[model samples]
Target: MNAVTELLAGWMPGQRWFGGKGREWADVTAEGFLLDQSDPVLSVHRVRVTYKDGATETYLVPLSWRESPVEELSSAFIGAVADPHGGENYAYDAMRDRDATVPWLTHLVAASTVGPMRFHPAGVAYIPEGLPGDILSTEQSNTSLVYGETAILKLFRRLEPGLNPDVEVHDALRQTENPHIAPLLGYVEIDNGPGEEASTVAMLQAFVPNASDGWRLATSSVRDLYAEGDLHADEVGGDFAGESERLGEATASVHRDLTRVLPTEPAERDWYRSLAEQMTSRLEAALAVVPDLAEHADGLRRLYAAVADTDEPVVRQRVHGDLHLGQVLRTASGWIVLDFEGEPARPLAARRELDTPLRDVAGMLRSFDYAARHMLVEQPGDPQRSYRAQEWAERNRQAFWAGYSAASDLQLSAGSALLRAFEADKAVYECVYEARNRPHWLMIPLSSLSRLTSLV
Candidate 1:
C-alpha cells in the first residue's frame, strides 16, 4: 500500500460517512483520481475497499496536499506523505481548504467543462459569483458547503455508479415549478468511462434561509404540550397540528409533481403481495434481533396480511424512500422538503423503486411518534407524561392525514389497514435499528408496536 492508502485505512473506519464501520478492512485500493497541478494540489480520489466479511464499498475522498501543515486545519490533517514529484507534503480534507474549493465554485458559476466532468447550472437564471463559502458544522452522511446564503452544495461521499435520485428528483420538480422543494440550482456530473453511466457527484440547491428543522419543531411542540400541566395537546398554545397538516399537504404536492414527471405504475395484486412479503421478512428479521418484539409478532402479521388480501390497485410513483421529520425544513413561506436521495443504505434500484406514496406517509407518522416519545425516554416512570406524549402524537397524526387527504385524491383515512401495515413495518425496521445502534431507545419503538397492535 502507498502512503495515502495506508493512512486512509486507519482513518476511514472512524469517519461518520464511511459505510464500513465496525468492520475489519481487508484491503483498500485507489481506483481513480482527478488531480489539479498546483502548489497545494487538489485531488479527488475514489477508494474501493473490501471488508473482512467480503463486502465492498467505494468512497470519494477529496484532499489538499501542501508542503507545510496548516495550523487552523490541524484537526483535518491526515498525515505527511511523499509526493510523486520527489517531495513530502501534508494532506487534509480538501473541503476545508478554502483556496482549493474556490476553484470548484468558480467552475460551477462559469459552467466550465474539464476533462470528463461537467459543471453546469440547471433551472436557475443566474449564478452568484465570488461568494464566500463555509462548510456546515453539523455532521451528516454527506459533506455540504454553503455558498453565502444563496445556495448549498452537497457532495455525495459514497460513490455509486448510477443516477443519484436527489439530483434527479430535484431537477424534475424544478421542471414542474414545484415550490415545496428547494430549486435545483446546479449539479456536477462525471462520465466514468466508455459504456459506463455518468454519475452525479454533487448538487447545488437554493438555500432556504431562516429555516428550522422539522424534527426540532415537532419535538419543541411536544415539549410545550407536556409542560402545560392541565391543558390537552390541542388546548396548548404551541400546538403543532397546523404545521403538521401543512407538511402533509406539501408532501402530497411533491408526490403529485413526481408522478407527473416520472414513470409510475399501478400497484397490482402481485406487487402488493411482494410488499407484504418484504414487510413480513423484515419483521421476522427484527424478531431474531429484538426478541421483545416476538410478543407483538402476531398482531403485526395480521396488518401485513390484510394488505396482501386487498384487491384494489393503488397508484405507485417515485415517492421519497425516506420521509422522516429530519428530511424537511420549515421556512417562512412553507415546509420545504430536502434530500430526495432516499434510504442511504439501500441499493440504488431498491431506493428508486416505485411504491405507494403511503409508505412515505407511514414514515412521517412514525417520525411523529418518535418526536413525541423521544423526550420521555428518560422520564419513563411518569404515566401522565407518557399519556400526554401519545395524545400529542395522535392529534398531529390525524391533522396531518386530514390535510393530506384534503389536498390529494387518495382518502388515506379510509385505508387504515394499509397505513397501519406500513407503520408497523416502519416500527419493525426501527426496532432492528435501535437494537443494533441505540439499545436504550429500543423501548420507544417497542412501546409503539404495543400501541399499534392493540389498536388493530
Candidate 2:
C-alpha cells in the first residue's frame, strides 16, 4: 500500500460512514483526482477494499490537503503524507473542512465537470453559489452538507454501479409537484467507463429549515404521556396521533405519485411464496447473529407460512424500501419524506425493485413502535410505562392506518397476514442490526418479535 492508502485503511474503519467495521481487509487500493486547485487543495479519492471473504467495496473519500496542520481541524485530521515536491502535507476529511466545501456548489452552479465528475442542475430551483457548507452530524451511511439553509448536498460514501435510488426517485418526482417531497435541485455523477452507466456521487435538494424530524416529535410525545399519570395518549397535550395521521397522508400521496411515474405490476401467487422464503431466510440469518432469536424462530416461521398460504390480491409498485420516523420531517405545512435510497446495506438492484406499498406501511408501523418503546430501553421492568408505551404505539398506528386508507382509498387493516409478515421481517432485520451496532437496543426488536410471533 502507498502512504495515503495505508493511512486510509487505518482511518476509514473509524469513520461512521464506513460499512466494513469488523471485516478483515485482504487488500486496499486508492485512486484520486483533484477537484479544486485553490489555496487548500481539494481531492476526491475512490478507495477500493477487498475483504477476505472476496467481497469488494469502493468508498468515496474527499480530503483537503494543507501545507501545515490546522489546530481547528485537529479532530478531522488524517495522517500526513509525503508531498510530491519535498516535505509532508496534512490531510483532513473535506466534509468537515469549511474551505473545501465551496467548490461543490460552485461547480454545480456553473454545471461544470471536474475530471470524471459531472454536476447537473434540475433547473427547478436556484443553486446556491459561493457558499461554504456545514456538515450535519446525524447521518451514518452518508454525509450531508447544508449550504445556507437553501440546499443540502448528500455525498454517497459507498460507491456502486448505476444511479442511486434516492436521486432516481427524486428526479422522477420532480414533475409531479408532490407536496410531500422536497424538490431536487441538482445531482452529481461520475463516469464509469466507455459503455458503462454513470454512478451517482451526490444529490442536492432544497433544505427545509426549522423543521423537526418525526423521531424527535414522536419521542417528545412519548415523554409527555409518561409525565401524565392518568391521561391517555389522545388526551395528552403532546399527542402525536394527529401528526402521525398527517405523515400517513403524506406517505400515501408520495406513493401515489410514485405509482403514477414508476413501474407497477400485479403480484403473482409465486411472489408471495418468494417473499415468505426471503423473510424466513433473513430470520435464519438473524438467528446466527442473535442467539435470542432462536426461541422465536418456530413462531416466526409460522407467520411467514401464513403469508405464503394467503391468497390476497396485491399490486407491486415502487415504494420506499426503508420508511421510518427518522426518514421524515414534520414541516409547518406537512410531513416531507426523505431518503428513498432504502437500506444502505441492501444491494442496489433490490432497492430499485417494485414492491407492495404495504411494506412501507409496515415500516411506519414498526417506527411507531420504536418511538413509543425507545424510552423504556433504559428503564426496563416498569409495567406501567410498558403498558403506556403499547397504548401509545397502537393508537398512533391505528391513526396512521386510517389516514393512509382514507387517502389511498385502500382498506387494508393492520391484521392482514402480509402486513404482519412484513413487519416481522423488518423486526428480524432490526434484530441483526441492533446486535451488531447497539447491543443495548437489541431488546426493542426482540420484544416486538415476541408479540408478533404470538399472534395467531
Q: Rate the local accuracy (lDDT) of all candidates.
A: 0.85, 0.92
lDDT of 2 by residue, 1-456 (tens): 889898888999999999999999999999989999996999999999999999999999999999999999999999899887999999999999999999998898889998999999888788889889999989799999999979999999998889999999999998899999889999999887798888899999999999999999999999999999899999999999998888889999999899888988999989999999999999888888999999899999999999989977788888889999999998889999999999899988889998999999999999999999998898888999999999999999999988898888455766788888999999999998899888998888988888888885
Q: What digit string (tens of lDDT, one per residue) describes model 1 on residues 1-456?
A: 887888777677787888777778788897445556665688777788988889888888888888988898888888888878998899888877766666666778778777677887884655555674578887577988887778888988887778899988998888798889989888987777888887778888888889999999999999899889899999999999999999999998999889889988877788888888999999988888999999999999888888899765588889888999999999999999999999989987687778888889999999999999997878988999999999999999988888788888665565578888888898999999999999989989999899788866
The per-candidate count of clashes, in order, stands at: 0, 0
Task: Name every residue pair that clashes in candidate 1.
Answer: none
Give model 2 RMSD, 1 decimal.
1.4
| lDDT of model number 2 | 0.92
